[model samples]
Target: METTHSPIRPIPVHPGLPVIGNTLEYLRDPLAFFRRLQRDYGHERMVRINVGGRATTLMLKPEETKQVVQENNRNYGRGKSFAILKTFLGNGLLTSEGDLWRKQRRLAQPAFHRQKLAILAETMIEEAVAWADRLEKVADNKPVNFSTATTDVTLRIVTKTLFGSSLGDQLDSLSTALANLNHFAINAVVNPIRAPKWVPTPSKRNFERATTQVNNLIFGIIESRRKTGETRDDLLDMLLRATDEETGEGMSDEQLRDEMVTLFTAGHETTATSMAWTLYLLAQHPGILQRAKAEIRATLGERSQPSADDLRAMPYSSQVINESLRLYPPGWVMSRLSLGPDRFGDHAIAANEGVLLSPYVLHHDPASWPDPEHFDPERFAPELSKERHPYAYMPFGGGPRLCIGNQFALMEMQALLIVLLHRFELRPVPGLQVTAQPLISLRPRQAVQIYLS
Candidate 1:
């Protein structure tokens, strides 16, 4: 009963050329290529993929993923996994490692705890309602560019949650700056990691402009707060008051700015992408849509407005969000380098051997999910999820580095979906397919159009 699985031969490699493995193939159509691999080669394969001149094997199996994320977490750190994000996010929590990351994580932890989220839920609801109410005016068959709508809402939510009302008009420059910065980060990923930021390229110049814009805007906020000596009870207030529990020291204004920018990027973009996918899924499946509507109608009872309590009563709404993330995870692709020797199920992985995982692949594994490609929210039903492997459905990722903003995301998504469903029926426009565009988050390549009926 206790015998360890013996090491097996390395799984068959997918064909590739020298100096460049499956990079071109992957770049062409990653999701489709991944599907082709899964059909030809199951989860255990060691298919080599060239990632910007580096030959790294893509590890697709769920147990393989568990080894990297949970059992041997310390031996792995983000490494080059998020180099592309470095251009925009820098070394904030999403990409940093070792002592810096550990210290920052400790400092930022209190602002995202359960009690904090409960308090913030009111603000989340306020922002969701403000956006949803605007949609009530759109006529039937009029297409709504949901991607833009969610982006605006998530940005505003992050702003209000972080700064409260005091910094109201001050956020305009920050939002404009961030909009340009995200594109630069997306462009960086298309090129090699070694390219210097000061390359005189158009994207590089644009990146600097956006980065400078944010830096100037943040310094202004800090100066204003310092001069007035006023502390609003938002994320900014929490950071100001948060003394390091171990050392009793507080973060510098510069430090706070870095963390603020981090939250703004991580806190909003991923959630926007998640919202886009959730709306697309709702548009695709009207049966689930009606069930979701019934829950909202019954709980809220023909009220023109819905409260947080009404959102809580809709179980199927939460399940729909969960299922959407399952099928199309926001943090879809992740990689980590081994710091020391490790053994995964059957492979002996040496130190610095990079491990790759695509949540898109693991979430849709045939062995783990019935008709793996299908979108079924019931898969997240408590009873059903318990029977599945814990690692099989990781959209926010797994283990310690899992996104701290996950609860913030889920709550916002639930509230938004509840309000939208109760207000309008979204139907997909003809001939438009929702295609995944991988960036820091996975988004639909085309604008996910939903006609508000």
Candidate 2:
């Protein structure tokens, strides 16, 4: 006898305006839109919604997310969602797909290994100490934008570690250019109807100019290194010296530039955002702040420089950073296009469909975390965390496409927090409100004002 199977059903669609669908609601407020989806249709595991004139399914469960990003990831690709990013990042690890991604990942893997990153910890601590010293000169109790401050310090750290040289006078220009490119990329992602590349709109002009500026800076570094025959043993030197085992071939200057810019942008932006949020949370919770400071002091008494071993010894500090990432993950939402048909429970998905996975949503799920809104670092304690689903708390993402620089970012944050907290006390400024702004990264909607004394 032959057996019959029930046909897969279409995922429920969220009601929205004709044609445009949920774009307005999404653009108006992305986080709220996600929460609304969770409230209204989360039981379905997947919900279809039109975003920017395309139908996409929002993955609502940890298991569903794991399947898309890990178990059956081959059926999904970066697709058109990353077109704007590819415009700037070229085919770097974040945006590349298939064999290219595999090859690049192989080549870049060695540069971010534990041993390689251990050597960079000294540079990270020095930069953090220098930042703390600069802050010491500022008037105590005066308000400072901690968000911008963190960005500046992280940028310096990444520049030194990546290029083996301080940015010096070029810092401001490079920062501005990268900011411009980031702004353009996010806007273009939401507004699908963008002017043609040659149209020369204000945004387009700014983007092109910024792209050129960044290109000049990166290519200049590569050219100078080649001409000087210098080996600083920094990330650049490692990439320069890396060769494919099969072909014994190395990355060309253009390839190096792509990977370098990808690392530079991703390296600084995500770490800075995480640090800013961590500092902000500590300011709001005085007890947590004090406890973290006590841990720092106990771990490194009278020692301003924190070594890799010192970082490992500060578990509470690590927990604080972990909790902050859970609350305000920099890479909040990720997108992929289906390359083949797939299924989630009884719901059917066709090839070419778009899928959205949000770490922010998963991290805050009440099912996985009781009293999810409450700030609690102890939730990440090894004893408690071992019981949770692996995909339930993916701050740096997961699977093969996980952020390559996750370890680097974590150590950078740990070093900065240890040095900065040891040197001064951080107090939130009165009457200042900070909210999450969903950009290329989840940034504070405004300057996170705080006082250092």
Highest lDDT, which number? 2
Candidate 2 lDDT, tens digit per residue, 1-453?
995556788799999999999999999999999988887786787799998888999998899999999999899998576888999899899988999888888899999999999999989998999999888887366877888898889999999999898978787788889888888888987676777677879988888899999999989989999899899869999999898887888898988988998999999988988898999899999999999999988888887667888988999999999999999989899999999998776787889888999998898888888888788999999989999999999998899999899999999999999999998888888777789999778999988888988
- Give me the runs in candidate 2 sitting further than 4 Å from their true place: 1-6
Best by TM-score: 2
Model 1: per-residue lDDT, tens digit, 1-453? Answer: 897778565646777767677778877877888777766777454465665667566667777788788877888977574776765676677877888777778888898887787777788878777887777665445899988988888888888888776356667778878878877766656655446645687767777888998888876777777788797758877877777888888777777887888888878888888898899988999899889898888888858767766667778889999999988898778878879987655666677777778888887788888898688989888899889888888888888888777887898888778878888887888888978877657888999888997
Model 1 stretches astray by more than 4 angstroms? 1-8, 43-46, 166-170, 193-198
Candidate 1 local lDDT, residue 289: 88
Clash pairs, candidate 2, are none
lDDT of 2 at 290: 97
The lDDT of each candidate is 0.79, 0.89
